[model samples]
Target: MSKVSAFLRKKPLIASLMILLLVLTAGCSGSNNASQNTGKNQVVKGGTFVYGRPAPVTSFDEYSEITSNNAFAIDKVFEPLVAFNKDGKIGNWLAKSHSISKDGLTYTFVLRDGLKFSNGTDVTAKDAAFSIQQHLIDKGPLAISAQVASIKAKDNKTLVITLKEPYTPFLSELANFSNGILPNNFGGVSEKQFFKKPIGTGPFVVQKWDPAGDLTFVKNKYYWQKGKPYIDKLVYKLIEDDSQAINQLKAGEVNAIESLPLENANELKQNAGTGVLTSGSWSIEQLFFNTLDKHFSDVHVRRALALAIDRPALTKALTFGYAEPANSLLPPAILYNTNKTIKALNFDTNAAKKELAKSAYPHGFSTNLLIASGNSTTAHLAQILQQAGKTIGININIESIELASFRDRFFAYNFSTMINGGQADYPDADSILAFQTDPKGFSKSYWTHYTNNNVTKLLYEGQKTPDGPARAKIYANLQQILADEVPYIPLYYPDVLIGVRSSVKGLVVLPNGSVRFDSVQITK
Candidate 1:
């Protein structure tokens, strides 16, 4: 076994041991029911909440380049300039108001005074400017936002941002926790130190992180919100296995978990009193054919491969009908042209054989299917593809590697065919395009290595325009181009499932396709 795989294998046992100790010390039930029952109707005071999370965090530094789980965890401890309102519109959070210049080059931000960091430092425009510049300094993962040309502090309560160009999606970018404002005294830290010891300005303070077990957060007494964050402490336990996570929730060891398996949903629903469940949009699995590869270089071969596999069957078997079969490159639920000509290629084994015969090899050639290791869903999907490919005389050898290894290999164009799953970074269609089309020509980052001149132009135009209607049209055209290019074959869009405790209330879904835990409160 590889080092990562070995570590992952050992991690669960360690977590279990830690959990056992917590159970022994804290008692079987996590509830302080005596206090809770008496004060149930009164102002929310405090109670420690232990919860289960589905994935392993790649990093804890809110500003560092890391995985999605890293950002999700950071959101709990960081404050952003603006937050998504109920209508999914960007509303003021740290900034009281903001305006873009007529030319769209400069953005002026009016700050809310008297806001203090967790350390009691007054949040000022200089702090905002420094936080923005930190991204450009290669100090942390926040370096992704180096696209900003200048961030100037107009005054103590006012800030002005000058962009390299008219970035239409800048607001959506700001919504990312990586852009969350840090205290002025917060020096840019190394990537290693950043994750190990993270400090942020948010509603909670990290009390402890037992690396092998749980991360505990106490409610920030100095939180900006008035008489809020009713819960005393939030405890996040790292339970790697779905079965174990569900078991903990049922046993009342943990309060909630994300991405619950659909197969177990019915069983959990049967015990509705103990487990409360909800679903939202989060992730999609896709088949990425390396266009740089000689075999997939042909459009007909790509189309034929698309036709051979049965997405409906795969979805039913893997996702228990909880996911929508996605044939189009653009997700069906996206705000773009819903009636666009993008449609699923039908499952036809005969057609696939005919297409293969027309190619240089009358018999289909063998290829390796690379997948994220230790992921059951990807393995299941690969098995389905292998069975379907056999019928079409296309032999597929499946290879499962750890995510970190697979990402490095795939980005280097070392893998040809892979079952790649992409989670939507933002609710926007532009986020989808960043993965497929490569106008820069065979990018190591773009696994598809897809090059389309027309699509590239449309993407540029879309990024430049601030008008929503015009932007939609641009994305609509790009989606059609994507359908024609076929860099990625869509598989399924899985509905995000979350299991929460009965007493937990106000657990609303964030627009970024994650749960807003800050808004959650555990009632008596």
Candidate 2:
């Protein structure tokens, strides 16, 4: 699972109980019209908005660490040529306009005139081309760099990108926050110096950073967007404990917070001074099997375990009815997930037993299930699997460890099976699928270490095909193949929940789970 998911999954019951109390208090106060009240307020500037994050940002550099925890902060300092709006549609941001060739292999972008970085340096087409080439050289967390054959600056205002093949979701891939443009001389800077003093063409500039504590930003005077970033200052307070963050929100110490405990989210919806914003994200929590493990080597054993879990019940229990059961790795919000006919592996213990009987160990086998410690939801999931395993004659041993230890074992390919969370960097299926199935270029991010020739071929073909019925068919077949193979069992997709003070207007939670504060204003 992604670090954000793990952070949010902690202290669910306590958060729920706290929310119940807050809801009762809100009921006795007055009518609930936080949304209407917010709309009635006028946009005012010159206030510091304090936001809360459950964890500290691992790195300031976008290419070094692109986790959701740091995305909102990074976006304030850097911008992609194209970006996803609040509605999840791709729109021009730094670029004035863009076009794709008829062959679908070449993409051209025209830079807006007089763009300047936070450091007062000119941002030209050369910076765009250099940023992409730097990502390719560094082989960052994102997989989009793998498809680029070449990137060249036609002139000061024009940039061209040539792909190895026709990639239909190329535009969406560029919209990813990880693909944010950097300064031309960024490659020559040392990592430590860059983190301490980062430069970008974004709305805000880093004023102060307290390790493992908080990050403060001041408005960028050279920001290209005129009169934007109405808020003069943005503060991200790092509080690893969810309960403390919720308390801070209630006390008005913070203006906004995300990944609230489900129960707290429920109660905050009725609170007059608070507004709860919920939106679907591309994040998916799933069980990934290590194909290198002996027990999971057999398809029958893998399929049996997949069929044994009741996804609908698990989803309801974990999310408190706020999230829907995920049938595939790609959520329905993405463009490639157009196929609705493919059936998910249903819950059937009898069928599970029968499938296990076909495996080498007809009597079933024992294996360790790795999960992160401090996550109540994952602990509950592990217990559910343990009980269900007994019915199918399979034995499961749950091993819960700290997040650091879990990552160590997971990326080293030392686990049998693990329940984790992952989010597509963009809306494209290739963003996630390529890393999972690409045998030749799989990074440490692909913890499952799954390798299948057929799956790899399908992923490659899907990337080469343009967007249409043919491309949809390729992805449809690919999902079916992975479903049958049982490399990663789809669990559920959680809703992105944000709690904001009613006075905070125009705060939008993007589908990718990043907060857009360009139009946000704090009303008195």
Candidate 3:
């Protein structure tokens, strides 16, 4: 079956019809509109929006954030030059207007007048230029920065950037959390000092932050957007348990639950008025391997694990029929992503055993699966993998570590196997696809150290190639190459779920699973 046909088969009859209707009227948000109160008087703002956070957030260094929890929290206190709206359209945030040269080599942006950081510091073009340059300096972590040749502040109000080549994803790259603009030269302070208590041209200012507990944010009086961030304060309380999160949502304790699992969607929707909001995203939950590890060094072992996973069954177990099994590294929703039936090494325990038998460890070996602590979803994923590995005589040990240590270990390439998931910084495929497959890509910057020459060439080709069928063909080829190589086992591309109180209005969750709070209002 094709991607769409398979997707419909996985969902309920009602949901399948809804999906067909969605395809007919494509741009409609697949959210609970009646509960969100779209037509309600959203202008009545002034309540504190207490959002429940599912994991620990220790860092505020926007450009170096390791976890989505940290990124989502800090996003309120930092502003990006440009961002993708819910509709996948790029919109100006800090820039009033922008223009690209005819050759597409040079780009100029005019800063919005009267822009100021949370601390009331003037947000100048120099600050914007410095921020972009700083991100570029951290070259390995930022794939998009490689496209830039030079960044200069033409004037206090004008910022110009010269690109090494004509790249399509530059604007979307700016939307990445790690690319948020920082104060000029770290506000005349050391990088550590500035990040300790960061200030930016966002709608909120960090008031108090407890990495293991909760975070409080006050409305930014100096925010460039006038009379915005409807809520006066935002308290992000850390809740690790899924049950507790749902209880809190229903008890009227918190207005939002970040990263709510789909299994609890119905309970929340039935009990709490309009408690769930879901958006299609490019996010993929996958299991990665350290290619150099003793057990995974052999290609046969890696490919064995890929075929061992029952993706259809795993998707149902993980999302409770809320998500479709991911057919490729990129979700079918993304541009240039193909839904054609692939010759994937799908679930076949017998084939998996045969491949494992060919490896150096013919009898299977023991390895630890690293996941962030307090994430029930990943914990469950670990359990499922543990059982599945057992079927093939592999002993899977799960190690749940805190966010801080997880980051350290991940970047250090210390683990044998790990459960990881993420979407592109923006909607474009290269924002993540190349970052994970190409040698100059994922292995260089991310956890997966897998490399292929063909993947790298295709990635570079896809970047310079303009938006058309030609680019799509290049990306499609790249996907096939990665699938065959098995750098990672793509589990499923999940829908971004948020359990929200019906009273919360004007909240915007982007397709990449990030939320915008500038317009969020809490109603009683």
Q: Which structure among the candidates has the greatest TM-score?
A: 2
**Alpha-carbon lDDT, every model:** 0.63, 0.72, 0.71
After superposition, the stretches of candidate 3 with alpha carbons farther than 4 Å from their true spots are: 1-42, 401-404, 440-445
| Quality of model 3 by C-alpha lDDT | 0.71
The Cα RMSD in angstroms, rounded to one decimal, for candidate 2 relative to the true structure is 6.1
lDDT of 1 by residue, 1-524 (tens): 00011111100000001000000011124355323333545443567777676455555665543355456667777777876532345677889999888878888888886787776777889888877776566444223322577889988999999887887667756766667787664646654665576666677887887755678888776677765566778887887677788788777777777656666666665664354444434345677788888888877777778788888888888887567777665445445533236655768888878877776656788988888665566678899988887887778999988756776787578888987655534434444454345345223224577777788888778768765778877877777666555677778866555666556665665423455656565554
What digit string (tens of lDDT, one per residue) describes model 2 on residues 1-524?
12225521110000001011110111111122122233666446667878888666656666655456666677788899998665566778899999989888889999988899888889999999988787677765554544788899999989999988777668877887667887886846875687578888888899998756788989888989887788788889986566787778777888888667665676677666776767766566778788888888788998998889998888887788667788776666666663256776789988898999999988987889998765456778888878877788889999998765776687689899888766655556676666556766534326566777777788888877766688778888888888888788888877667877777767777655677877777766
Whole-model lDDT for model 1 versus the true structure? Answer: 0.63
For residues 266-323, write the lDDT of model 3, one tens digit per residue.
7776763545777776567778888878787688888888878898898888787668
Clashes of each: 2, 3, 0
- TM-score-wise, the better of 2 and 3 is 2
Residue 437 local lDDT, model 1: 59
Sort by TM-score, best first: what order? 2, 3, 1
Off by over 4 Å in 1: 1-30, 33-44, 85-87, 139-147, 188-195, 210-213, 337-340, 358-362, 373-376, 401-414, 438-446
Best by lDDT: 2
Candidate closer to the true structure by TM-score (higher is better), 1 or 3: 3
Candidate 2 TM-score, C-alpha based: 0.88
> What is the clash tally of candidate 1?
2
